[model samples]
Target: METCSIARIIRLQDLAMYRHKLCSLLFRLLPQLQGFPPGPPLKKLCKDEHVHVALTETKMVGTLPELPQDILMVIFAALEIPDLVRAGSVCSSWHSAYARLCNLGQYKQSQTPCLVYASESDPDNVLCLYSLAEKRSYKLTLPQPPIRSRYLIGSSHGWLVTVDERSEMYLLNPITCEQIALPSVTTIEHVKSIFDEYGDVCKYEISWHTGTRSSRKPPSIFALAELRGRLQWKAFVFPDTSTGSYIVVLIHNPQAQLSFAKAGDDKWTWLPPHYLYEDCIYKDDILYAVNIKGELHAFDLSGPVITMKTIITIPEHYDCDSRYIVQAPWGSLLLVFRIVHDHDLEPQPGASEYWNTSEIKICELDALWTKIKVINCLRDHVLFLGHNRSQCLSVNEFPALKENHSYFTDDNFLWTVGHTNNHRDMGILNLDDNNMEEILSPQLCSNCPAPMWITPDLRKMNLMGSMSQQP
Candidate 1:
């Protein structure tokens, strides 16, 4: 009996040492885990959960059902993107722990990007998210009016710019499922709602004119169903640094015009420039816009008056099908040119036509020299360019991403009409070889919104704090 007790004591001592070493390693790696407690990094055990490790000297011993949930979370949180996703799939207990961490607003600093699209199976309400790390598609349900019917023009800071059936706009946070209504589309200076005999909005008459060269052209009439998405080419949402409230910049039709609205504004304020702005981005409190002719402009909305400052001269040729602006990982600004097939250089965008992007050319803006330099290789960064806000992520941070590659989606609005089920034009492009290969399964490829990329996040917004001050 004495010998047996001695053996138990040794076993307990071994277990104690093992736990100590495990904790020591985790604490050392804690500094690397982002969003860790603010102060000195330390192992924080969940007080409610104790494994019941006894020294055996007291003649008491117990076993845990599994590793403590809190410890499992710490280890899972520190894992690389793919491993963390796999860890959650290991067992039910692990999944719960992972879910808790995700629910706790842990959109880790290096958030992994997910392919956001709508599926026909549950098209009206479900959003299909394809995770690159896990190579799996997950469905998330957003608040009412169904994501399928809405036009997702852009996604920024985890919120999507959705245009509803009434041609009204909103900012929707996919993870937290929060919605903020924007100014009505009819509020634009050129948009007029045409009411039917029953006093319901059935059509819209929007004025169209060419920049600087043409007189006012006859208005174009669009039915309510088509006008919902046809009104805007793209939209972007950003926070006004001065007020902490959000500002939404829109690239609308009537020739890709520029307009903006504050968080609580009753109407959108036009920027007065009609240069056919193709894409826009907000950085360092300045809004940078790129036009169809590759001209770059900057606007400071906080001032008493908004003036469009020309940063770069207009390009001589307009061969590039689409132009996108993204801030590089290293802080330099880049302009990406997406070109489709050679034969389809001037292909008209028809209601049912699909566009498959063929090649992508990147150019870095030499701000100091005021010239654009063509970059043959993206180096360690990958570009996600298409309908969603243009994004550039580093390859070092996301191991799943291939260097010098571009993952593109169908930014063409004509193919993504809510009423139809059409195959999307999305694929991964190898810059080195200019070869494109599809990665999505056949089913996911047939969805609405055309497979744009959005970085998955669970950050809760302080809607009250985001309310804009009276302009």
Candidate 2:
């Protein structure tokens, strides 16, 4: 019995010594592994036989002692540009992560979504970057004084475009501050009438897209203009009641059918309306629009007629009406609406209210439009103010949550007000783990009241001015 016991003790001691050596080798090679759980595969790889044999043999399966910055950069570079901006708030290390990640090819295919929030106090608008990846915030300066007395529309390929109260159209780069004034009418006649009568009465809408099969280098910008004039409509009778103002702009495809009724003209004319309804997203040629019922519709730009799909719906009970719907970085659509809920008006017992006056709802697109959450009471505007709302939107689809159902896992978006101050915030909500982090708040900028809007064209590396000048 004593002999058998001695043998067993010796065997156990040998196994303990082997495990200790294996663990030491693994820790030396991949220190980051300490943070993760030890699975069977790792255990097998770290076994006594595996460790010394692999180290002694001429062949090592994988690289060892990985460079932290280089791996961070790879993870950083893989992130969408906007994500780096959001990551800026995490810490100084992440801020450095932000700068190194801005390589040219990152945004070659599609631009990042950048918005310039200009305060009357400051001549230039504050160029705030909303990264689609990390889904956070950072600040940049505008190229020149944004078209004064006009609403800053957005940018395409680093070019910033805007329209004024007088309806004047101007395009510039916020980064380099180069401004270009486009002609009143590119080719359409209704636009000419609006410009002539109203002195640029039509408001300019900008949609930025990358080249299709024809061009692969830089992205293209599509300008959409809404013309409000008395005109004819085939869909409606004399003076179509269904139509208040006709949308007249250069089509994205330049081949889609466009019909317009000019001011004081008796008849409706046919033109291309490809870019009229929806904003052009660069990834695929899918065009997106929101119908009167407040449902998001998407169609192929190359197709003859758009077969619109209702990606999401705005519940009628949402209280206030919604104007725009923006697709968020994390595979979800953000629906912005103006709600009028009275504070003095007592709330119903056992009732759940989302927002105050203007409510912003984040809905996950994949699963049935589940209202992930909403932001109602934003800093000090009591009595439910339904002022102005627009969609500052972008989507990044990487480092996604393990489960597909979790939409908020890695999503980000932007919102710019018309009259209210340009207050911004970065929100991070992971439904999978139910983890939500919001840094840099809208309330922080309540003192800096500025009107800002988003530009679709967000490319990195190039100066904003040169990017605008590109073909």
Candidate 3:
């Protein structure tokens, strides 16, 4: 009984307070009920509908009081450097957010993850570098006007390796705007020596059927120089007839062989005769030289002689046309290349039908070197396998498509330039569940830029053997 009485009294008190103002005004004007107690009656009149109206209006405006700058800075500092800068232009309250973003020392030890250099088929060909962890994009200012170079060879640390149309090499730190000139090679003497060895150097023809070529002069070699953080150039005649000598021996085309140059007080050294038949890739502490006979050889930087162990010898019948190899997620290496189109595929003459055919293969490098047939995409194919996918192309054959490839986390999410017959755009192959989503879409760049290699973070780079380099 007592609880019920208390609850009833509370409700009555609220009602009376709500009615107090109007009731008092009525009583005063009318000179009636003047004997009523003002205080108690006013408390009863407080439950007015106007109170609800005022409360609702206040909530409509999303007004969060300005937090102190110190608190804002603390919150912003937790964000990645790029996110904080992006928030700066939002409003004055966010200005403090921007200030805390440039805490540069916090990122010094991390090696800035991987630096990404991006360019398109624009007339100006603007090159930009992005730090994956910082999520910040810095435009690369070329030392002079932009050159006609459209290919990126590789990147080490913050330095970007690139080559031009005529095979001129240049290295640049997109972050510091520093450039280094690299020795360029127009032709290989080993390739010429291979022909000389086979007696195919005389007046002959380059026939596709017999893989024949005429006598040709040896290739020219250039010495690379980096001075005062600026690039300079010098030319030197190779096959130095003096004390320094490099030899060439060809096993395949007799046109492509190996050349090794003697290291004479200079840091740069090449093995001659530089064999043209063998293709090489450097990773970790070892350099891999694979000959045309499907023989894999390893040369150690710490040791004087190459290892005698047979790393891998692929069978010719299995197709050994892989042009690129990368270390995969784990310790296994990935070899990438296309399977030759079946010559039996005869075109339908006078028919408007177009045939799409290609076979992309992947081989894992380990003790046994396991091979897995990974994917088959349409049109001319290029493959990138890694986190962020920012290395160089397997081969620097295409100029405009030097830095144009983008890889997302999802599987079979393939995006490439000119993967279709249409020249105006690019295509994507989403093979998540074996169902291919062939999306033919337009690109944002004017020049149909090809996808370049992605440089992953330090941890991933270490996985892909980016920690060491040839001195």
After superposition on all C-alphas, the RMSD of every candidate to the true structure, in Å, is 10.2, 17.9, 20.3
Model 1 agreement with the true structure over 98-183: per-residue lDDT tens digits: 67776674526466677787666664777876778657666666788888877788877667888777778888877557788888
Please report the TM-score between candidate 2 and the true structure. 0.38
Give the lowest summed-lDDT range of ten residues in model 2.
Answer: 228-237
How big is the positional error of residue 188 in model 2, measured in Å on the Cα after superposition? 5.8
Cα shift from native, residue 165, model 2 (Å): 7.1
lDDT of 2 at 58: 31
As for TM-score, the candidate ahead, 1 or 3, is 1
| Better candidate by TM-score, 2 or 3 | 3
RMSD over all Cα atoms, model 2: 17.9
Over 4 Å off, model 3: 1-125, 128-150, 155-159, 164-167, 184-268, 272-284, 289-293, 304-310, 316-321, 340-357, 366-450, 456-471
Local accuracy of candidate 2 as per-residue lDDT tens digits, 257-362: 2333322233434332222232222224344554346555555433445454556655654654333455444455545443324322234776532222222333
Model 2 residue 279 lDDT score:
24
